[model samples]
Target: MRNIMYAAVGLMMTTATAMAAGTPYHEGSATIIEPTDERNPLAEVVSGIDFRKSMIREMQEDEFSNPGMIVVDYGAEIWEQVDGTAGKSLSDVWESCAGMDAATAAVSYPRYHDGAGKVISLEQQINYCRETAMGAEPYKWEKADMLGMTAFIRYQGNGEAINVSIDGPAAATYERGKELYYQRVGQLDMSCAHCHEDNYGNYIRADMLSQGHINGFPTYRVKWNGVGSTHRRFRGCNGNIRATKLAYGHEDYVALELYLAWRGNGLTVETPAVRQ
Candidate 1:
C-alpha cells in the first residue's frame, strides 16, 4: 500500500509536470501538491528531493496524524478562555461558533462585501467578530490568541476543498491581487511568478521548490515547526524578489491573499492551527 501510494504520488507529480507545460501557468515553477521545493510547475524537479522521506506523506500516516487536530484543540481552549475588558471569550461576542465547521471556510473567503466597504481577509473578519460582537479588544495579529482561534475555527473543514468566488462585488480585490501577482516590483525587478511559476520544481540549495499554492496555507511547515500566516510567507517571497516588505497586516497582503485564494481554487486547506 505504501509503495502504491508513493507510486500514485509519483504519477501525480509527472502528470502535474506534463500538464504544467501545456497549462497557462508558466511564471516560475508553481507547486501543485507535494511538499518538496523541486516540484514546481515551471521546471522538473531534478536531483536531491529526498522523496524517499516525504514529511507530508509521513503526516498522513497513523503514527503522526494528529497535527491538524492538535491545533484545533488548542484553538478551542483559547476561544472559551476569557480575555479583554469584558473578560469574555469569543463565544460571548458573536454567534457561538464554538464547534462549527471551519475547514470549508478557506474556499468561501476572499469574497466581496458591499456593507463592510472593503475586501477582508478571513483572519481580519474573525477578529472583527471577536472585537465588535463579543466586545473584546482585538488580539494582536501574531498573538497566540489569533493563531489559536484561526487554527481552531478553520480546522472544521479539513478535508473539504477550497471555494473562493471572484465574481461578486468582491471581484475588485481579486482583480487587484491578480495584478499584484504579475506586477514587477522591487529593486530586483521580479514578480511573484518570476520564480514560482517559471521555476516550479527546482532546487534552491537544500530546498526543492514546489508550485506556489495558497490553498494549503496557514500550513504547518516542517521548517517552521508551526503554523504561519500566509502573509508572512508572502513577505518572505517578496523580500526574496527584492521588493519592499509590507507590514504584517497590510491591505496589500489582504488583496494578494484574495488573489491567491482565487488562484488556488479547488485545492484543500490544511490550516496551521491543526496539531502537528
Candidate 2:
C-alpha cells in the first residue's frame, strides 16, 4: 500500500526532473562499465551511473559540476585541520597506518577489524580513528562532517575496483547480511531482492529499477539536494518500504553494507556519483 504510493511519487518526481532538465526520462548505456572480476552474481555488474540520465552521468564525471564535490571539498579542508587533544588530523593517522595510500584503502571498507572484533563500515572506521588516534570527538552519523569526510575519502578511490573480502573473519557477518537481503519485512512485504535482484532494468513507473549496488555511495541525489552516506540511502529504501528505520551505523546495516560491497566486488568505485 505505502510502497505503491512511494513508487508513484518517485515516478512523478523522476518524470518532472527529466522534463525540467530537457532530457529524456531514460538514457543509453554508453557510460556503463562492465566488471572485470568474475565473482559477481550477475553477468555484468553495472554502476548506478549506467542507469542514470546522461546529464547526471556528466555531472558525476566533472568534479566541478558534481554537487557532491562541495562536500568533498569540506572533507579535504578537515583532513589537514589540526584537532583534538593529540593535535592530529585524519591525514596524520593515515600516514602512520602502515604507510598505505588513501586511494588503496578506500575500497577495502566495511571490513572486519580485529580491534573492534566485528565488521565496521567506513564511517565507523573514521570515528574509530578520531576517538582513538586523534583523541577527538567522533562525528555523528549522517552529519556534515561525517558525510563530507566519507565522500572525500571515497572520492580518492575513484576508478579503483571494489574488492571487499567476505571470507574468514567476515564470513558470518556476510551470511547475516545475505539473510537480511532476502528477508521480507514492512507492510509492503517486499525484500531487497524483490526489486533489485529480480526486477532490475525493469521500470517502476517512470524510474528504472537498479541492481542496488553501493559502489558509488556517498552519492548526491538531486532529490536529496545534498550528499549522503550509504547508510542514509539504506534508511531511505527502508522508508520506501514502510519499514521501521534503523539508526545510522547499526550493526545490521553495516553487515548489509559488507554484503553489498561483496556483491559489487568487481565494480569500479564512483564515489559521490550524482543520481536523479
Q: What is the C-alpha lDDT of each candidate?
A: 0.60, 0.82
| lDDT per residue (tens digit) for residues 1-276 in model 2 | 999999997997676545434233134433454655464556666666666667887999898999998998999999898889999898999645423467866788888877667888888888888888889999999889999888888889988988888889999999999889989988899999999888666667777777889998899999999988888889999998999989999989998999888888878888888998
Q: How many residue pairs clash in each candidate?
A: 43, 0
lDDT of 1 by residue, 1-276 (tens): 999999997887776555434222232333334322221233332211112134454563332573645665778897678766667777565344312235445456655543356777767767766665566677777556676677676555555666666666776877788789889988889887776566555434444454565654565666566767778788877887788889877888888888766655555665542212
TM-score winner among the candidates? 2
Measure candidate 1: CA RMSD: 9.9
In model 1, where do residues sit more than 4 Å from their true spots? 1-53, 60-69, 82-88, 92-104, 273-276
User: What are the models' TM-scores?
Assistant: 0.71, 0.86
- Give the residue spans of candidate 2 off by over 4 A: 1-39, 95-99
RMSD of each: 9.9, 5.8
